[model samples]
Target: MKTWIVLLASTLVLPAHASNHITDSEKKTPLQVETIAQFNGIPWGLVLLDNQTAIVAIKNGAAYRVNLATRMTTRLTGLPNVDNRGQGGLLDVAIPPIANTQNWLYFTYAKPTSEGSTTALGRAKLDNNHLSDWQDVLVTNAVVSGTKHYGSRITFDNKGHVFFSIGDRGERDLAQDLSNHAGSIIRLRLDGSVPSDNPFVSDANSRNEIWSYGHRNPQGIYYDAKTDTLWSNEHGPRGGDEINLIRAGGNYGWPIVSYGKEYWGPSIGDGAEKEGIDNPEVVFTPSIAPGSLLRYKSSNASDWNGDFISPALALRHLNRVSINQDGEYTETRYLEDLNERLRSIAQDDTGVLYIGTDSGKLLKVTLNGS
Candidate 1:
């Protein structure tokens, strides 16, 4: 359930630019943003297939194949009917490498269950317009008793294997449980099997699919093009949102070690800076509630060169960081004044940028300098 527990600061009017525009109430900037297409439901995922084509996944259990040049959108068929209640709904989507040869697409959805709903990640092919040859790739192991915190985001590595993020399922202790997949990073074969090289393949205290553990609800999972390192943005309780560098068998320490406290305003473990718990590369004391991640290589916009971009939903700003060698980052730039919940970020092969908003709008941000 969406709560009005926030009061965003008003944005100041900036010079006319492609990244932002001044609005009246200032409550919604990108809501009226111009784009080639729009979303029919709560947007969760976005990706650029190429220069002219892009894909957007919505909570309405639909994914839209978009053409940027023509300003047209085509709804891809054969998506699952999701349990769209509370925060449980259709989630992350990705076009895997096999999609090139087989038109295969991977997606995750909230599968209805008697206890509640368990988040499931599945892979299937798009047979000319229909989803054909469907296969169940993976399902979260923990029992879901609540409709909140179903963290289901998917990505692929250089080896072409799949790495998915499963939320803690609102049961904090489950994150520390090795038998459960909840609140951990799961790495799997493209055909949906646990790989042999996994950290806990034969461990009695861990699930084979788990790459890392102790995460609350991570929304962004991206692989760096050069380093091949994975980066994720995890949502903290109230504040304490984090940008983490994920490693094989690393423990992120959610309820055990956190930058923020419990939602009821109690202390969450030791603190932000602890010894055993891996600290975040950067922490958002007042949470920005990051939803999507896009690593820029070449210039996506006029001002932004190659950098890691995280769109802030609760903060309504885009924070850009310069990646350094020692696995650290410096705040390089910030795209401010967009007062809307940024849902996703994508840049086509040609380098044009597109930002999707939760308010049913798609924004095309470019450079206006001549």
Candidate 2:
């Protein structure tokens, strides 16, 4: 065995670009993190096709087909021109449950318009080594003239309806308005058609695709198969980040009942709680800047089963929340020693975890001796 050397000379002995795979000494579970691949730009989102292959979205207006083993990345062509402005670019990607038969892939990005940029969701067949027949399924009705707050996370429910989030685009009041798709999670049929049973389908003034409204740049969303619950995490203005159990037609009071204060130190609204709007199950004050969320039901690690894993950017760690059937939760921090700003995380069929970082590294997390 090669003996690891500890340099007593200086605090910063390693080079600036060195790969870090630090494990927490207090961790009871035997797990390991290995950096397997690297990208040229920031990897915003990832979807594993199998253990050895995956697709990654870069924030710099491109997507790549990545080989997990060899680290060979091929840029996927034929995507719509993304408005790669401040806080706007190619975002999340998802594969349908029927991908084996349909060969379809869904993506969300910041689409440019005459007015400005809006969050857009599109789907296309993955054929002939690139995206084909791609078209935008939904775009925000009101295209505001700002580059910030385009909440563009995508997830599919058990009913096969596609759900994607759009941020308020710096327009806080639009979240309360039912007429626009901004600051809401929009659910639609597979063919981009409006589901007739949608809450706003009968309302003449509201957009038919709105599922739940009053979100403020939700970057992470997941559908729990066991509980049939849709969970989302959004960034707060200064200190009031939230994790919510999403429901149809639910109004998550943003700018109205925020636990968070304003960026310059003022109350967001009247108070923390309101009458009709829903409150978040979890609220993080002083802000962790949550980037993505995952619901892990791993057979290998029974301790981690039925737990929610949220990777954060500001905190630079993976958060583990163990929940019981009664809805009580205990929180822990995983991969705390890595000290990297993680972007997205996913798990394979065999219970292996893959993590993407803002520093352009792809890491695999697994139980030791597995």
Candidate 3:
């Protein structure tokens, strides 16, 4: 979940001009930002079917099939019922790798249940501009009540496995429990069946769907086909936001080895590192509140290939992280002048980036001369 801080109403006021070119003295190309559309609700997640058509999910229980060319938003029907409580609602939307062939749309949401709300995964056929033939694939084993930490993000790997994350739901201890789905990344087939090769498939006490465990609240996840890597960004306590390289059956120390301090200023866990617990590839001490993760892949932007791009909510900027072959990285911040809480980002086929903000606006970022 995003920080409890509410955005100032003034942040919604658009600039006199919606487009501007921002250049860094050290870079060759300037980043051109354009306001494409503004929303009345929080745009939680988005995916572009083509360069001009997008399916956007709102945190307030709604989804929209937006026409980027015309600045039109059509509220999509046939979505599942969401809790609509704190940090829960229509979350991430993703297309399978075989989208063009299968026409299937997969999404994650906080599903309302008698016991409480649970992170749920479902899919439907996207045809004629509406969702049809809805199928509920998976849900968390334990449904606890909370407004924070649903940890819902979806990604498809090249090996035909679907991975989705679920937060600890404020139950920090649950992260270490493999029998429960909370605080873990789960892998399954496109149809929602557990993959036999999943890490815990043969374990009697563990959930077979679990791929990795000990996540707090991971809002951003991406699969890097080049490295065959699964990467995730999760929120820590007051600090300690982390970007991790995920491995099957891996144990990430949550409540045990966090670098973050507690909300009231106490150290979390037994310092930052511990034996047998996986360490993060990157840790943000000040907390960027990362929202979405995308692996940049383009023939044109050779320099940026394999880098990770994402919006930082608390930091109010877009981050371009260069991950080198040696597994080290450097971070660059972009669009700081926008000063809005960015929630989601997607890149079009042309390599242009689209970003959604908590200020209820949609923005486009392109290379200066593109």
Best by lDDT: 3
Ten-residue region with minimum lDDT total, candidate 1:
1-10
lDDT of 1 by residue, 217-315 (tens): 888888775778888887888888887889998889887888777878977877666676776776765677887776765533443566667777886
Give Cα distance to truth, residue 177, candidate 3, Å.
Answer: 0.6
lDDT of 3: 0.82
In order, candidate lDDTs are 0.72, 0.79, 0.82
Instruction: Please report the TM-score between candidate 3 and the true structure.
Output: 0.90
Q: Return the lDDT, model 3, position 189.
A: 92
Estimated TM-score for each candidate: 0.85, 0.90, 0.90
Ranking by TM-score: 3, 2, 1
lDDT-wise, the better of 1 and 3 is 3
CA displacement after TM-score superposition, residue 349 of candidate 1 (Å) = 1.8
Order of the predicted models by lDDT, top scorer first: 3, 2, 1
Cα miss at 131, model 3 (Å)? Answer: 1.1
Q: Give the lowest summed-lDDT range of ten residues in model 3.
A: 9-18
Which residue pairs collide, candidate 1? none
